[model samples]
Target chain A: MSKKKITIAITGLNNTDNPGPGVPFIRAIRESDRFDATVIGLAYENLEPGIYMNGITDKTYLIPYPSSGSEQLLARIEQIHRKNPIDVLIPNFDAELFTFIKNESWLRERGIKTFLPEMESFMERSKDNLSSFGKKYDFKVPKSLPLTGAHQVDQLFEELDFPVFVKGKFYDAYKAWDKHEVNTLFHKISAKWGLPVMVQEFVEGTEVNVIALGDGKGNTIGAVPMRKTYITDKGKAWGGITIDDEKMLSLTYDIIRKTKWRGGMELEMIRTRDNEYYIIEINPRLPAWLYLAVAAGQNLPEAMVRLALDEKLEPFHAFKSGKMFIRYSYDLIGDISLFESITVKGEL
Target chain B: MRIKRSVAVSENGFVFDSSTGDSFNLNGIGREIVELMKNGLEQSDITQKIIERYEVEPAIFEQNLMDFQSMLRQFNLLEE
Candidate 1:
């Protein structure tokens, strides 16, 4: 007997210097023997390497940017569904997750299933609300102040020290060492991503990350913690090693239990010299480095697919510790005609 | 402009600079331009080749080629 073939639509396929998680997500699915799948790559740019990479996607389609609003995105998804019904959609970008989560019901009505965090869960865990989240969840987060204007930058110095982190709501973080740098970044970030730029205290510690899945019922499906051994200038993990840290695992379980989170999440933290874990960010989707978790034995992406299909699954018991992952760049060879086809026709 | 003699470029667009111990991936156009540079092709020759092969305007191809050359310089792949 053969396993059923599942059609999964995925986004964030930009496998560049700063990669998206789509390629790794598809890799996990391909490695799984439980279910065969036809991977549909939803890309934003014509140059996304995943679209051209062989054995990664069966079909690729261009989608509107999230800035184009949820209505346009839904329309594009609907068009794709008309051609091939999407069994499940696993959106991997932080900026786009809100749009997908907002239209979750509409997608389900169209027979496109998605397992995502509840709206409230997604909202409260954002970087803007991290301080309050830490307060409510009884965890230590770095002191952060949300600045909506230039005037707020002046007051930031009184409350926080120099060398604070200036962060955009969706992306970009720069360490500003003086008031001039703070105000400069404030305007830069505001110009790009709009107001309410975050000012966070620079916590001195080693950075660590955990990728985990929750069952939406306060039960953790699986969790794997890793420490970056080498990071690129863009702050992306180029090499990392999985470690067996009881405290980090416990903290992951506690957060999931508190939020009753559904689907995949990545927790970025900083462990101080004293061994205190200060969670810096909570990404509601799988990280680009999530293949490390699958390689270590969790296979969370496969579990997520099953969970989205409403299949009952037992929590992952154990994963191999001390596993290391070194990311390498692979040049996907293709002709200029393929690029022109996608650029002109919007699909390949 | 000349490509550094120590820069190892594979047919698959994997560029490894032994002097700096850095590796990079290039798109098809980028690889073609770099290969042309290695072969000591003039700027006009490279521009002509790209315009004939790609479905892009000659002016746009020139602008893109300049940008790609700037990136190569930024990555220190060009000889001083």
Candidate 2:
């Protein structure tokens, strides 16, 4: 019998210059002999020297954004399917995940399977979901409020103590501050990105992350806990050490079971001086350093892909529980601007 | 495969028995092998079944099974 043909369509390859989370996923596919795939970029311009261009994908397609509605996006993807007929569509970026989930049924009807969870599930597991999930698990989430306007920003500072965080609903978080700096920073953010934003009570302590892959059926296939030793300008953990913490792992499992989460997801956590773990927020996408987990011996992306393909996924191999991975950003050569910014941000 | 519960499982898969806490996020194949081990299947039997069920060569299957078993053993999820 001939080998079954499986085509995968991945999005957002042209958005960033560096190897984002998509690189590792694509690498896993390239390493695996299971399927054939064509990656489609959804950005306005082409990104060369990218992981895909650097031999990660079998083929690459640039799909232009529609000037009109989502139907255009669907039509474009459908057109690609007519030619290649993708068996699975795995979106790596947040917006791509959102778009795929929004048009999930339509794509499924067209015979393209996706690994997205329910849209409502995304909302329920969002950063806002952090506090609620924390409350359910008897943990405290930092006091936070969704920003309404620049005027309300003052009230936020007044309501809370100093060192509040001004964050976007999307990715930015854990920004440190006192009252005066936050008050000024609030206006700067509002002027750039409109409200409502997230103003969170700053939890000072060591930073940690919890990652897990689920079948969306209340089965957590695997989980990992790590600490943040370094962070990037884009708010990604640059270097980190994995640690073994019983309480944090329990909390992570509790949240996953409660949410019935699927695919790959990450949790941001803070350890107070008293060694208490406080729930910060949940990022529903894969981390850029996810490959570290795979390198540590738990290939989460491959597991998710196999599970999505209905292949029997083996229970995760037990690895070194506290294995650490430190991400080193390459090509910072002579970039004094980056150095200055790191100094100002104090994240170096 | 054998799945001995540690003091670490939280009704969810949050495992923390460092004695067996972290390991390969097993692919479907690895998961099956572990389950078989947990079920008291010997490595030889598991390899035999893997060769019969999957298209991988017997030698490769044997090596992978041994490596996977060693990994599990190293993590304290299995006894010698």
Candidate 3:
């Protein structure tokens, strides 16, 4: 049979030391034998390395940041669709998922299909709302308080102990050891990611992550649990290996069943010395290390496209445990003209 | 007395439980015990081997072997 052709539009191409999901998501799809896909890279910055990487994107287009408002973001997407209509649109950033979720129907009207969680489901997994979400869902999320002002830092140690995490609203988390550091991170995070930074009580344990896919019907389509073998100073996983984690997988299934999650999600959890699992944060979309799941025999990006196209899929029950992924940095030199075109023409 | 089927001990005393993705390094004595365990040696038989090789008293080596066995069980590296 001839492979079905697909054109997928994806954002989050920032492949720096802190990577994004776009490059790996595209790599997974490109490796698929069932579909011949032409990838359309949607980048927010001209210098995102994936925009110029070979065998990654067929055509690259710079899109307006979603912080500008959904209408403006949609207008830019509409322009891209006029040039090359998107079959399935995958937005891969927590910061941008809000705009995409709000405009789901509008994108569908233009024949661009997307599989994303409802706004309610998305909000339920956010870092600031996690403690309440855990209480409602019967999960063990860490105790956290949202701070809109620096004055709230004084109340932090009163409620929770020190050696806690001072986290930005959308990204970045620093482990603070004292009030001085907490106050410093509060201002730093507030300056960058806006107000209401979260201070979460530290849970001391081995950190484990699970990448999962849900079909929006209380069904877990795929899940793979991994443990980072090496971590960078920024807390990103530099090397990780897949593990047999029935408890973590079970928790993921329960979260999906409860949320009726519609797309790729990642669970950041800590397995305590006593072997209890505490969810630290839940990402609403696939993580920067999503390609690891693909290597474990659950091709979530391919399955997501199929689900977005309304195909039936069975839940994945098994994956290859002990598989490892070690990430490294190498410079992919490109001509200045390539940078000029992406900056000037906004397409490469 | 029996190592889990998924556990592997390398020549350099490196051990890994493939099923759980947990890895550890063992000292020379620990590696020897694990090597004997992997070879299907019973606890009493392994005790004899350790006594001959390390020239330790039988009573003390037996207690240590039992403690090592307990650790193997705790780490899920021993079969039930």
Candidate 4:
């Protein structure tokens, strides 16, 4: 039987030193034999490598940044939809997701479907709100203080210990061992990402990441836990290996069940030396290393696409253990004219 | 200024220094300047070429180019 053709638009195409999940998500979709997809790459920057990647995206269009407001973003999507109607739009950036979630009904009116968590779920899972989320769910989460100003950094030591993690609201984390370092990072992060910086307790242990899909009905569609073997200076996983940890898997299922989460999510957890699991952060979308889940036979992106299309699927019960992924950089040679085209026309 | 003899650059703006075993990615303008440097072009000549083709001003491009040169040097991709 011939596969049905579908047009799916995805954002967060910035695959750089600090990578985005778009390319990996595209790879998973391409690997699936279930659908013949027209993958549309939505980029905010012209230099995003995925935009220029040959044969990965059928077409590429530049989208307005999230800070430009949802109205502008909706207009851009509508423009793209007029030319090529999109069936599903998977926003892969955490920063842009709030806009997408807020405009879900508007997007649905235009026939653009999305699989995302409810607004409350998305808000509760934020780094600043994780402490309350953990308390409500009866799970272990690091102690975190949300700071709206630089002056709050001075008071952090009173409640939190030294060597706490100073994190931006959307991205970036720096370990501060002293007041000076905390002050510097507080200002630095606040300057770039805006107010409400998070000061999280430093949990020392092995960092384990889990990629999971929820069915929006307290069911975990799939889950894969991985251990970062080598991390870049930017705190990105350079090399990682999947581990067989039932506790980690159970914790993932528990979170999904409790939240009744929908769509793709990545839970960053640390397994302490005392054998306790502390969920550090919850990424609302598929992570940059999502292809690793596909490699491990979970194929979460494919499952997510199926769910988005309203196709019923049984929960994924098994995945291969001991799988590994080592990310490497590749130069995709292109013409100077291509760069000029994307820079000038905002599409390629 | 010159790109180190051991550095390999690809058209896609990927730079690798075999001696240091370090790999780096360059933006489009960075790649253009590096290629021009490889051809033994002076900083002013490369800056002139960039300003002619791109929509950037000479002063801004020169300042950015100097910063980029500093980055190149820090990464050991450049030599005096």
Model number with the top TM-score: 3
Please write out the lDDT profile of model 4 over residues A29-106, one tens digit for every residue: 998889899999999999999988887898899999879888888889999999999999999999999999999999
TM-score of 2: 0.70
First chain of model 2: TM-score? 0.83
* Alpha carbon lDDT at A174, candidate 2: 44
Mark the regions of model 1 whose C-alpha exceeds 4 Å error after superposition. B1-80
Q: TM-scores, in order shown?
A: 0.80, 0.70, 0.94, 0.81
lDDT of 4 by residue, B24-71 (tens): 898887888999999999989998899889899899999998998998
lDDT of 1 at A293: 93
For residues A26-131, write the lDDT of model 1, one tens digit per residue.
Answer: 9999988887999999999999989999899999999999898878889999999999889999999988889899999999999999989999999999989999
Candidate 1 docking classification = incorrect
Looking at candidate 1 chain B, the ten consecutive residues that score lowest on lDDT are B15-24
Interface RMSD of each: 13.2, 5.3, 1.7, 13.8
Candidate 2: RMSD over Cα atoms? 15.1
Q: Candidates' DockQ values? A: 0.01, 0.09, 0.59, 0.01
CA-lDDT, candidates in order: 0.89, 0.65, 0.91, 0.89
User: Local error of candidate 4 at A337, Å?
Assistant: 1.5
lDDT of 2 by residue, B24-64 (tens): 45567766776666567886888888888888988888887
Which scores better on DockQ, 2 or 4?
Answer: 2
A99-199: candidate 2 lDDT, tens digit per residue: 77888889989998877776876876565455665666566788877776667766676677767777766655546556566666666665554555678
**Residue A336 displacement (Å), model 4:** 1.7
